[model samples]
Target: MKKLLLTAGISALLATSAVAQTIGVSVARFDDNGLTIMRNGMTDHVDTLDGVDLQVEDAQDDVARQLDQINNFVASGVDAIIVNAVDTNATDAMSVAAASAGIPLVYVNRQPINMDTLPDGQAFVASNEVESGTLAAFQMCQDLRAQGKSGGAQAYMLMGQLSNQAAVQRSKDFHDVIGMDMCNFITLIDEQTANWSRDEAQDMMTNWISSGEPFDAVFANNDEMAIGAIQAMKASGLSMEEIVVGGVDATADALVAMQAGELDVTVFQDLAGQGAGSIDTALKLAAGEEVDKTVFIPFKLVTPENVADFLN
Candidate 1:
């Protein structure tokens, strides 16, 4: 009986060792709020699977770094490879490498523009960015109208990486959303891409203010930019209430500002679920379990009235 018990214990140890499948999860940049939430989700998912280990990589929005990371993951023989591309077109080589190595690749958040179709044994998931951008635009415009402002009112658009498919679609959706008859007088004074950097956004806003650009509202593409816009506002001797501030990706900081009446409105892109779902799907695919071909998280507008419910 003792011998049998020892054998059982040994089997259990072996089973434990076989759990967390090796996965290489990556993102374009770690500085953005949306990416942080997705990373959190991925880590949480990894924890749930006993043997599943997620190797998270931040490309810092550089193609070379991303390419190197992808190559390393392939060389390391990670069971699965995942990426949020820095340059969608440039990522073809990584996909090709993955195919040659027999490793499955998954693209998260941003879809590749150059790769018309994904290779077999690969999948993609993302938030419905059109809804997020439209909601953000709608909220900001409503707030401006509430202030009895309309027609020819200048606004500035601070945006994300132009190369990203999500960024491009979001920007397009924002313009479409704001193209209502009521807002015909609205003038987008400047629509420059910020690469979603807070410091860069601050510098741009400072320059715009210095140039005496006649704009009242600042529509930053992401929450980080909105926060940076706040710094710019303060630096420019303007209060938060001086202009209608809007953003996407409702991170904790942005939510706090909303509760404190500092920020006007934003859209919650539900970033946390991204990483977790990606891991779950990748593992399922590796294990020969069924998984969705495409999973898209939803977006919701966040305002002062709903902020309490959201926070709690």
Candidate 2:
């Protein structure tokens, strides 16, 4: 009887240990291409970790909804929380809530407006937006110059959501790079925000085509917008030979477009790296281990010549 009781106690303890390891993740929206890649990375890591349970919630691009989801995670006593914020500006409230509950918080993909305000158990994981934009700008200029159309060639920029930190940084970096003497020959004729929507970018590009403004190149902040611009340009009787186009995020669709000779260049953001980093950081924090306040995965430039390496 004594041996049986001891065995039962050990089983109960093991069950309690398994239940204690739970992580909650809140995504801004699952529909976004970049976020989708991140989600896959997160899912892959969760599958490998032992005794860790992960719960994911999609905020659908609503700040209030994201915050509420975080609150729910706190109430349920999750071991840690990973957030892909809808708005970086609202991170203060999120930080306060997570800190108050004594839960470690990890911000993935989208960065907050400021990281200084985060308490001890919070951190961020992503690539620098400046790197992606700078690489895209240099590649675009290189392609234009090679075609001998650098001087007096007009360029149009298709911006992502204006409020997103990545969009703002990428847009600023592109212009800053082009303003340099080497690329100054290229003129930015028109620029507009597509809010990172392929459909919206298509409509905007269609309007630009109807206006009859001659642009030699289109620089989109992401592959979705770049693909949209390509669709519009093709419908308007413009061929890839007549115009140069580039984008950030070497998503699968973008890579296909590049292979088909429809996209000239794209910058690769390491989706799997960021996703795995976020999960690792969250787990470390939960285990009372030290982690850097900000962790960055590097970005790479992808062109047809080297695109094959990134396809897998």
Candidate 3:
């Protein structure tokens, strides 16, 4: 009977070992709030899987460092690889390395530049850039009109990292919206790249304020920049009601800002959902299963009326 019991235990151990799969993940940076939530989502999802393991590394916003991490993952024989690109334009090397090694590669959050030419067993999982900026900008436009600024309004834009695809696309989205006849009353005073840093955005806004450019609105590529601009504006004694502030990525802090009547509009990018979806796609590709080349999680518009829905 003891021998039979030992045999059963050995079989269980073998079964667990056979099902184990390791995924290597490289994130653009660990300091960003949005990326932090997405990374946590990946780890939390791994907890629910029986025998899956995730090895995550931070690239610290360096393109070369991110590529080296991918190479190391490949050398280590990880079952699959996930990358949150530091620079969307510099992802071709990463794709090539993974494809040459016949390992599945999945990009999360940031859209890769060589997306159309990606080798088989590769996919991208993230919220659509078109929707993220459009939702936020359109909401801001409407808010401006409601505040009796339909006649004329000037605004400043805060851009994220120029190398990021999301930043470029989102900036285009804002321009597209304001060009429409219905929203044309809004004019852009100036736009500057804050590189998605709160402190940098605060400084930029302060400089704009010093120029005495009477602006009615501020558009930011992300919530961090929006909050930074708010801080600068408030410090300069500009009332929240005087300007319409809009941003993308309805992070926890952004939501709190909206609740406090500081942020006028924001778009929910479902960053955590993208993280979970990337893991699922990577596992599928690793197992030789089929998946869409691009998997897009939808973006949602957030405003004071419905901000409570996302606070949790």
Candidate 4:
């Protein structure tokens, strides 16, 4: 009787272990501010679910590395794969790999060039880029008016990588909003890509400062570039009172700057929401459940007055 009981117990334990699911996550780069926050969210969600294992890999902003990681995941027979693509244009290879393996692919944070090309079991989760730029522009105009310098406020734009969709959409939307008669008082003095890097943005700002041109505001597509611009301005003996600086992502450093009156404005992208939503959708797909092709979280404006709400 004792031998029979031991055999039955072993069989049940093996059955339970076999039912556990495994998920694979590939990030564009773990060092990115927003992507780091998203990764935390993914980890938190995975911890809450029983019998679900998460395998995470970072592509370090390399397309080849991202593809290699995806291939490995496919070979491992993971139930689903999530990717924060390094380059939106290079998603075709990723999609083919996941689809060929009959696994669901969920793209988070950075969106692909064409959503329609995603296979039936694929999906995307991100906040709209347009809202970030539009809100920043609106806030800039408002701050300018409050300072009693409404008309003809000179502005400089610090762009991210031109190839990135978030950078493209944010730049376009800012221009569109500024083109409206309500914001026509603002004039763009110059624009250049900083490649979404703090050091690069600082170098660009240093050059612009050396040019001796006067600008009322500096708008960066992301917080890192904005913070870089601010550092440059500070080193050049320019104060926040002389120039309004704004950016997206509402990153922790940016929030601190806002509180200290160093940053003028920022647009808050829901990083946590995007992260959790991606994992939830991926898990559902893994379980053979249906999910929407895309999930969009909204962006909000964050200024000094409302910065505290987002700090924690």
Candidate 5:
């Protein structure tokens, strides 16, 4: 009887030791196409791990709600947490909450404002913003020159949500690229934010079309907005061949647009890779292992010539 009791106790201890590590994830919103792919990647990758559990929540694009989720994760004693921030500038409180609780935190896809000041066991995982818009705009510049627009060309800009770091950097990238001598012939006629909404972008594009501006190109911060602009131009009876359209995030819909000869250029930001990397980083951090504070997945330029290679 004594031996049996000892054996039972050992088995119980082994079972306890095999308990899965839990990770709490708070995404900015679940309805976003690109972010949905990322969130799916996280869930799929976790499924492959031996002892891991993921608890995902949508912050619904609310800063206060995202902070509350972080606090809740801490209170629940999760081993680690991953956040796809709604407002990149509003992440200081989230970082502090995770740090105070001694839990590992990883910021995925979106950059946090306090990145440079992130405490121990915290990191950011995403593609480099500098590369995203620069690639698209530079490619657009080249495509315009190829089409004999080198003499001079006027273009409109469609920006993403202003609060997100990616949007700010991507917008800056477009301006910087256009400022270069090689691309200086391109003129930016007007710029506006669509708040990363397709419907808003379509409405904004329709308004621009109503202005009867003879723009040569449209540079958008992301594929959804680019698609929106395309839809608006089509509705206005503007030929796709007449204007060069460029955007970041070579999404499936964007690739379809490229195949249909509508979208001219885009930059491929690996949504899945960023998602998986965040999980790996979070797991490492949870285990008290050293990891880079920032992990960047490289961005690739996509055009009609090689768009097929990027198709789903």
Candidate 6:
């Protein structure tokens, strides 16, 4: 009687096996609040799929450490690996290693080049960061132009460090749009690599403001840096309204500031979508399905118009 009952239970579970799949994700760091939210969103989304087993490992923004983490997942024979690269350049070797071991990798949020060319079944998913930068600049330009300034508007950019893709693409987009005008009406007074740290951005902004560069606006590569620049401004007795500031990666604080009119704009990169789509692609590959080579998450300029729709 016991054996018969066990067989019946197994049969019933088989009926639901279509809803069961385990996916392993390696997130970059827990300290980045944006990434944490995205990871949670991924979990919630995967949970709804039924019987989906999701395991996560944190890389802590260390390059070699992340590589080691992926290697461990490979050794454990995870069905698939989702990698949020710490640096755009750190994962090529590991991508090669994983491919050699027959593991599929879906690179998320940050793009890595030529990984698929090495024979690994590779897929990459992330936001369009170039458009992110361009949108921020474009919005700022429009605002400045509308403010009755006949001359070109001046901007100060607190750039992310060279180590990350966010830095690379955001910088390119910011400059590209400005250059589109032949740059006669725009002057970038100064730019510094803040390494995406709020404190560093604060210090840099303080020094720049103290120097009296006469900047009409501040542009930051990420929300953290934008907030830091705001702090520096406040410390220097400048109101948020006095100097227009904008950023990318629509974090909570930035959104609050934007709503309060303390920030000019922020580009919304849907971190949640990037996370879910990346993991979904990885799982599909593990199940013997083809995954797209690239996925682009749309980015939008978050102003008061659409800020309410995205603030949550």
- Say which candidate scores most in lDDT: 3
Q: Kindly list the per-residue Cα lDDT of model 3 for residues 27-94, writing each as its tens digit.
A: 99999999999999899888999889999999999999999999999999999999999999999999
lDDT of 2 at 262: 94
Identify the runs in model 2 with alpha carbons over 4 angstroms from their true place: 5-12, 15-20
RMSD of each: 2.3, 1.5, 1.3, 1.4, 1.5, 2.2
Looking at model 3, which ten-residue stretch has the lowest summed lDDT? 42-51
How high is each candidate's TM-score? 0.90, 0.96, 0.97, 0.96, 0.97, 0.92
Shift in Å, residue 4, candidate 1 = 6.7
Question: Number of clashing pairs, model 4?
Answer: 0
For model 4, name the residue pairs that clash: none
Give the backbone clash total of model 6: 1
Q: How much is 108 displaced in model 5, in angstroms?
A: 0.6
Superior candidate under lDDT, 2 versus 5: 5
TM-score of 2: 0.96
| Model 1, C-alpha of 94: deviation from truth (Å) | 2.3
Best-to-worst ranking by lDDT: 3, 5, 2, 4, 6, 1
Model 3 pairs whose backbones collide: none
| Model 6 C-alpha lDDT per residue in residues 1-312, reported as the tens digit of each score | 999999999988897775566666778787886788788778878877766787798888888888888888888877778888788877778788679788888888877755456354778888877788989988877777767553867888888868778788898888887787543477888888998888999999999988887778898999999999998998998877767788988888889988888888899888898888987788787777876788898998898788998855
The Cα RMSD of model 4 versus the native structure comes to 1.4
Candidate 6 accuracy as lDDT: 0.82
